[model samples]
Target: MNRARALWERVPAPVVDIVLVTVAAMDLWPMLWDDTRLGVALAALGCAALAFRRRFPLGVFLLTLPVALTQPFAIAPLVALFTLAARSRNRPLLAVCVALAAVTSSVPWPLASFSEVGRAMTLIDFVYSLATAVAPVLCGQLLQAHRDLARRLAEVEEAREHERMLHAQAVLARERAQLAREMHDVVSHQVSLIAVQAGAMQVATKDPNAKEAARTIRSLSVTTLDELRTMVTLLRASGGHATELTPQPTLADLHKLVESSGTQAQLSGELPPTVGTPAQRALYRTVQEALTNVRKHAPGATGCVELWQDGDHVGVTVTNSPPTRPSLALPGSQHGLVGLRERADILHGTLEAGPTTEGGYQVRLRIPLSTD
Candidate 1:
């Protein structure tokens, strides 16, 4: 049934109109052979007029009425009436047209013969013609109702899909909120103790090497606490409100970050103040990750962080010299560079990290200055 309907819709409008005109002409052909020139002309006009019934349904129905008057049970007028009924919403107007068609079909042509016909016989014919006229109007109204129902069903389905998406988002938000609470309450408290203990150890130590180790542990723990706080804020913000998040790091905080990194590092060069917030964050994260790596894997090494702008792009490059002393083994997930590369990709940028020719490591990130 669906395939049939699809095929029917694929047929051109003009082709359907032509088919209707042919069927109407066939219906009136026999009556035209026995009629006067005026009757023949009226029949031909009514048949041809069906081709335009879809556009001018009322006018076409009026034209087909003459053909119906010349003969009983005409097809042209019924098709015209159906077209008008489907397109028009005026019920009184449709009822009047139906009545006019029934009367025209029942009345004997050439009005002089009406007196010869019996009243009872005329009434029977009129009743039968009225019943015939009603069929097409009912069919047209049913089609109109079907179209309206289909449109309403489509709208309901669309609304259901939207509701499903909103429900999924709400579930995800709840999960994120719970995770944020865990990080703040449990993880943050533990990291605070590690930083406090390291600070106490640094103060109590006598050997220079032990003192340096304690200071480095304290610095790393403090940095981790700050990052944990930031993460908690981010998770809570994701759960409901953007206003929950603390102010993120930008170029303004670069000096403080380097000063507290527990490494020998130099900050140089300058980007335009017009650089966007996201690019600034990416740049800062790149330098932070680089200095942390130097402190862990390149003990006693010094690093340089340079910021520059080239044409439409702004970038930061961090380079560190080879270790002056043998490095200690450190636990790491090794996802820092991967995360940085992902962040660069989100901003339509790139990150490159590799060893320089001078037995040192270089990490560079370039992103659009207008990145949001």
Candidate 2:
């Protein structure tokens, strides 16, 4: 049924109008052939008027009334009535049209001949014509209802799809909230202990090399704690309105971050002050992650952190030379660079990390300078 309706709808409006006009004209021709010239002209006008039924249904129906008066069962009148009923919502107007059509078709033409017909027979004919007139109106109303139901169903489906998307986001937010709790309770506590122990050792150690190792461990531990706190706060905010996290690192903190990275890294170059806070944070993180990787995977390697601007873009690049000593195997989630890449993407930027030809590793990030 739906496929048939789709096929019917595919027929062009002009073609459909032409077909209706043709059918109406053919139906009226035989009946009006022997009638007066006025009758023939009315028939022609009624059929021609059907061509505009969709645009002016009421006018077409009124014009066809004369044809209905001459020929009680004319096709033009019925088609015009159907078009009006299908398109119009004015119930009172439609009722009046229906009654007018029934009356016009019931009363015999040439009023002087009415006395020759029996009153009872005329009354019966009117009742029958009235009922017949209702069929087209009823069919047209049914079509109008069917179109309304289809539109309502489409709206319901769209609402359901939107609800599903919202539900998925809620589920993700809840998971993030749970993860935030775990990080705050377990990971932060452990890192705090590591930092405290390293601090005590740095003060108490007598060996110069051991003292330096303790200081490095403490510096790395404190940095990790700061980053973990920020992550946990962001995750906690995901379940609802964003809560502002204070003292977020920006470009001003880049030099300090590189210095405390526990690596022999040099910071160079600068970006314009117009860079946005979010972009500054991204740049700071990129350098932080790159230097951390160097300290972990390239022992005895010196690093350089360079900040620069290229046309409308500003970025930072962290490069480390080949490790002088063999590196120990380290356990990691291996998602650091992947997370950085995702952050860059969110800022409409890109992150590229790979080994250099001189056996060094380099991580570079470029993002549009945000004036906001």
Candidate 3:
């Protein structure tokens, strides 16, 4: 069946119409003996009009009116009525055309009924003829209705799919903006500290050459800070609400963070006085992010925050034991560790944050330092 349809599709439409016309003409051939010239003329004209029925359904329907008079219950008239009913959207006009086609057929051509059945047609014959006339038009309307419904469904589905795609794109754009803000936070904090440290160094240096170099360093650091600030502003401005210009968390907040942790969180070891503000803030964030993760991923877990300094680096670690009970699943964007990693990179430091063999999560941050 599919192969036949495919072949029909491959055939030219005009060729298909010509074939239908020939078949219809053949069906009306038996009646051609009586009307002779009239019968043959009507048959040829009505059958040929079927060729353009799809393009001009109403016109072809009107053209086949004479064929209905000659052979009322014929193939040619029925095909024309079907074409009009299927193609025309004007319902009243279609109904009028179909009514005319059926009514004209009730009267025989050359003023006589079919003698083979009876001299005068019976009521049953007339009813059957009317039924046959109506059936094809009804079938055509039903098929056309199905086609229209399918087309409407397809359009609705395409619209829904387009909206879904746009929503997905918006989500991706928002996530990109958020990631940029996280990176900006880390860079700004580190750059701000650099500017401050450079200004202090310029003041402390006594030697002329050292002081000149320190001044240059201070100027460059200030410029870097300005650029970072601009970038951070742009990234955060993507959202509808304005970004809050909050102060970064530092060593001063370390005690508060530990106190706030519901777990048995303790801050141990002394922080070096020489540790820069950037390093302090980085350490504070490392501990803060780790503790937050613990609360989220391992509720009821105990944690310890350790801050210390070695000869060349300032170090901090936040460790949480496994949950006392079962872990509680929590909703998180999981951007904390990514931000911590960015901070460490900005300070030319290394951070280790992962699960321990003891069924705990550990975070370690180390920022490099040098003595002038």
Clash pairs detected, candidate 2: none
Per model, state how many residue pairs clash.
Answer: 0, 0, 0
Alpha-carbon runs more than 4 Å astray in model 2: 1-64, 71-76, 87-99, 115-132, 206-216, 246-253, 270-283, 308-316, 340-352, 365-372
Tens-digit per-residue lDDT, 1-372, candidate 3: 869857877998888898889988888887777667867887789889999999988888888888887774578888888888887678788767766766667655555534554635744555666777778789889868977998999999999999998898688668768777776778667767877887888799898867765675566567567656765665656544566554666788788767655456888988767778778777877887787677667867889888878779889988889887776566688788899899898899898988999999899998886421
lDDT of 2: 0.90
- Assess every candidate by TM-score: 0.72, 0.74, 0.53
- Superposition error at 231 for model 1 (Å): 2.9
Model 1 accuracy (lDDT, Cα): 0.90
Quantify how close model 2 is to the true structure by its C-alpha RMSD in Å.
4.7
Query: Between the candidate structures 1 and 2, which one is better when assessed by TM-score?
Result: 2
Q: How far is each candidate from the true structure, as Cα RMSD in Å?
A: 5.1, 4.7, 15.8
Clash count (model 1, backbone only): 0
For candidate 1, give the lDDT of residue 125.
Answer: 84
- Which window of ten consecutive residues has the lowest lDDT sum in model 1? 237-246
TM-score of 1: 0.72
